[model samples]
Target: MDLAPFKHVLLLPRVRPLALLMFFARMPPAATGVILTLHVAVTLDKGYGAAGLVGAAGTIGMGLGAPLMGKLIDERGLRAMLAVSVTASATFWLSAPLMGYWVLLVCSFLVGLLGVPMMSIGRQVITALVPESRRRVALSVDSISVELSFMGGPALGVFVATKFSTSAALLFIGVSTLVAGLLLYWANPPMIHEDEVVDGPRPKIIEWMRGRIVGVLVVCVGATVCLAGMEVSAIASLEHIGKQSWLGVVFFAMCAASIAGGLVYGGVKKAPSVLVLLVVMAAFEIPVGLGDGSVLWLCLLIIPMNITCAPLIAASGEHISRLAPPTARGLAIGLQGSAFTVGNAIGAPIAGVAIDHGGAPAGFAIVGVIGLLVAGVAWLLARQRKPVATQTTMAS
Candidate 1:
């Protein structure tokens, strides 16, 4: 695959620095995913259900709060939203080690609610900084960067907690998150200027949430649901096979496959639609159940299973950027973010319950079936989602 597009994207003004920030900024959350599950399961001696609940709490908050903060960014700009949310996130991360179970759960929800809108902001800035011609490649880089972050985040979280202590790991994440927040605040990223909104009628928020844009989000949510299922199931499969140590490698390889797919997608002249990518992703997920008995086998399966991840993410970001009205840019992106959050919020716990009851095979099947069903829904929606402009013009 060609590396030129990635190189061209990085050289853009204002993009390289934010890309750098993305490296550190995405790590802590990635780490938290691994660390929190380990901390609750290994340290606190909780079950997967409990761990899933905690995980879901954070995602639920993410789902609920992303749009609110996104709107804040739209109305007030990036500075205040970044400052307030990052501070809240830092406080919660730092205090997590000391809190009890219920408190930690509540805190998880609140932290996610208050979590910095980094993904939304980064995409918005990328939309603002790059021209339309380069937007897809830029978002492809963004998605690949996200995969790279997950490569380190969870493994580091698990490693630190294992070598030192969960408390130490939490402290590290807390400090690192604090620094990231500060740096982002200092960076003061740009927002959508929405110059056209100055003279036009204000479009209602629901208008943005329906039709083609929302169809993109449906694909996003479904894809993420598959991802969360794979994650939890992988964790269960590794533990089942007594090769739990290889968990990090499996996640890395899968993410690496996603990166590879994204790079290829970026370089291509013609790409598939988001719904088509989602269908491909769901199709790959079905065989995951067959690999449940062995970690090595599971890793082999994930190469195909993850081939669509980054490409889907890149496409969704591009469409959201292309679709939303200027004034509602933040909210639109925020809604997309929330869809993934909602997927994650529900995905793990459902998979965990499946794993708890019927083991890894069951979890895999559940994810695959749901993914296929959801992809079908997204595809049907996409077909029907003609832009209202064309229909309205035709009608008039």
Candidate 2:
């Protein structure tokens, strides 16, 4: 395997720190939902269903707020957005533990609406800092950091909640959020490339927002639909087989496969199209339902599908950066964040219904089929893309 691609990207100024920043930045948000669930279910003595409602409120807020925050970044700049978001986050998390259920639910939505725009910032910074040629590798590294954070963050949140207290967990998240925000503010990474021109007129939405960009965004949603559904189906499968204890091991294997896949994809000279990767990922997911009810078999079946995960995400980021005008990249990235949020909101419930009616196998098949259908829609939309017009700034 070629190590040169990885080395080249990391050696670029600012790329390594940005990657590390994103990893640490992602951890607190990754654990926020799980921490909230534990707080409601365990501390408040509420049922899991009630906890889920609060979580859903937060998700809805994120989906709506991401684009607004992105627009803010576009208008005012990164530091301005960060200051407001950091303040909102600190206030929310600090006061969250003391609130009653209704107050927490309402405040959760408000807090989510103002949550730090880390994910969007990470991608935008990559596009600005890394040249078009190195984006695949850079984005692959970013995706790996994301996977690592998700892998450790929720587990740590659970451990703290279980061992210490949910209040302690919430406080921990609060402190971490403040620190991450301050670091990001101080670092103050560029949102546009030094070679790129931004003082010119911003393009109207119609000029830059084309069918191809929409298609890429659609694929983003579809990819997450499959991923989130797969996770739910996996848990349901383990529970059905009375092997719930193996979940941590199974998830670790899946994440490791994703990281490995990302590393390989990044090192390659060329990467596949986002649509193509998503199709392959969805194809792999369908067979996971057919595993022979053993940990080894499940892990084996899961690996191939997950291998496409990071590559697909990296491809999506690469495509968005290429297609979107630099001036509008923040908003575009924000929409991408919203797409993933919408997918997460949709995926698990669909899988849950399938699991309830037809068991774990049906959950896998249903989500897999849906993912394929969505990918097909994205392909059709992409095919409708018009020829590019001449411009001062060339989009990828």
Candidate 3:
């Protein structure tokens, strides 16, 4: 099949709103690490452990808050939810450093909980606004924006923190978030309108959680765990080796690879089945784990490993959009994003502990094993359902 047809699918006519939403959604990831780093520096007398605990609190808060925000968006319109979330996030972030440790923890939690749903909302909006055939590519682009945010956010955070202070950095993050949200509100992107009256009350969470859709969510959780573990391990390893500065280079390589992979995947007319893609992506870790190579070799391995991240996310988004009821799409994406946030929260600590005691290779090996297991889960999920005739049809 000529893949040229698929290339056009990646280009949406009204992409401005999506781009704007993504810019706002990415601010937290960009700023959170720097905030934490600076918070630790300022509070070292309080204990490094406290900083870690606060960071964990923020992540947990995000994980818990996302689903609730999703439900609200389902009931209310995007504007209301965005306004509430953005305002809350901005207020918490701006005021965070002024508070005591316990209060900071609370504010961080509130910020994270309120801060995260914007990205999920953006994803839901894209699914609703974009045509089915082009949704995968669009989602891939969205994922790329997320990766870019991570790549760029920390650097920005560092600069802000260095130039001013941790409090200033936090303020900057808060302002950026508010600006993004306001821009999105003014833009008023098109969304699927809900009816005033429902046939019945909404389905129970358990009812919504049933079937292949849950499987996709599980895969997302697993993939996020692996990614987080890998990221934590890589950072720790580089630090241990006294090559901490190379961490940025390594991430840049990985992100560059992901961008190329996303473009390639978006262009493929006959992309592999989700199961196959999962397997192929998981296999990329083997090279990473087997080599004890230099930074360049590690960078090389990152490209293939990074390439799969976006496509895997795009696949999950496709599945969630296809399986969820129209009214519940927001909640569905929220649940998926929540799973990812939880996985990230869990992964970093686990990997950090593993690297501290067992060493870097052990940490990477652990992540690799997790990826393999997730691949197996993907295969089982694929087997449970009949394969669709085409990837595009599966997405629809």
Candidate 4:
């Protein structure tokens, strides 16, 4: 396997530290919801439904706030945005243990609304730091880091909550959030590439937000929809087979597949377009439904499907960086975050309903179809635009 791509990205100054910072930075946010849900259900005695409401509120707020925060980063700058978000996040998690359920709900929304823009910033900085030719590998590494953070963060949160207390878990998140924020503030990686001119007249939203860009965003949503739906279906399938205890094992396998995929994607000289990767991912997920009623079968089936996961994510980031102008790149990446939020929000419900009606197989099949449908929409949007040489280049 060619290690050239990884070496090139790591050789660049600032990329290595930024990657490490982002991995730590992502952990607190990753664990927040699960910790909060466990807190509400176990500690507060509110039950799972109420706990879900709190999680939903936080998710909604994050979805609504992502673009606004991105726009702020565009208008103001990174430090200014980080200052406010860090303070809000710190205050919420620290005080959350004291608040009643209702107050906690409101505070959670506020925190999410002003949450730290870690993910978007990482993408922006990575694009700025790496040349376009090396961006695929850079972002692939970043995507793999994200997979690792999500994997460990929640498990750590659960460990603390179970071994100690939910309040301790909340406090842990608070301290980590503060540390991540301050470290980022001190580092202050360049938000815009030096070569890009920000002083020039900015393009109107209409100019850059339509056609291929919209298609990329659609593919982003479809990608997450497949992921979230597969997760729900996998859990349900495990429960159906009384193998629910294998949840961690299955998820670990899935994450491993994604990491392996990302490593290969980064090493390769060329790759399929965002839409093509999304279609391929969705296509693979459908067959996973056929493995229903067996945990081992489901785990094996999801591996090939998940191999496209990180590649799709990295490809989307590469395209967005190429397509959007420097002036609005933050907002474009933020919209990508929002698209992910939208996909996760709806995907679970779609899968849950399908599972309720038709079992785990239907859950997987239905979400896979939803992904394909959205990919088709993306293809149509891209096709509507007159073919451009730049579009072809950006897709790679």
Residue-wise C-alpha lDDT for candidate 4, range 1-396, written one tens digit per residue: 577879878989989988999998998888998999999998999999999999999988898888888888888888888988999999888888898999998888888789897788888889989887788899999999989998999999999999999999999999999999999999988888887667867676677787788888899999999999999999999999899899999999999999999999998776778888888899999989878888788889999889999888899998888778788888899999999999999999999999999999999999999999999999888876632213443343
lDDT at residue 368 of model 4 (Cα atoms): 94
How much is the lDDT of residue 256 in candidate 3? 83
Q: After superposition, how far is residue 367 of candidate 3 from its true place, in Å?
A: 1.4
Model 2 lDDT per residue over 315-386, tens place: 888887777777878888999999999988889999999999988888888888999999999988887744
Taking all chains together, each candidate's TM-score versus the true structure is 0.90, 0.96, 0.89, 0.97
lDDT tens readout by residue for model 1, 288-357: 8788877778989888869899998988888877677767788888998998887776677788898899
Please give, for residues 1-396, the per-residue lDDT of candidate 3 as tens digits. 344644464455557546656766676666786577577657435666788788878878888888888888778867888888888978877776677788887777887777747668767776766677677777777777777777778888888888888778877887887787787778767555232123566665565455466567767777777778878877766776688888889888877877777667667775655555655665676456443336776777667777888787777887777666666767888899887887677667767787788777667767667767876765565444432211322222
Segments of candidate 1 deviating more than 4 angstroms:
41-49, 193-201, 352-359, 385-396
Clashes of 2: 0
CA RMSD of each candidate after superposition: 3.3, 2.2, 3.6, 1.6
lDDT of 1: 0.80
Q: Tell me the lDDT of model 3 at 196.
A: 19
Root mean square deviation (Cα) for candidate 3: 3.6
Clashing pairs in 1: none
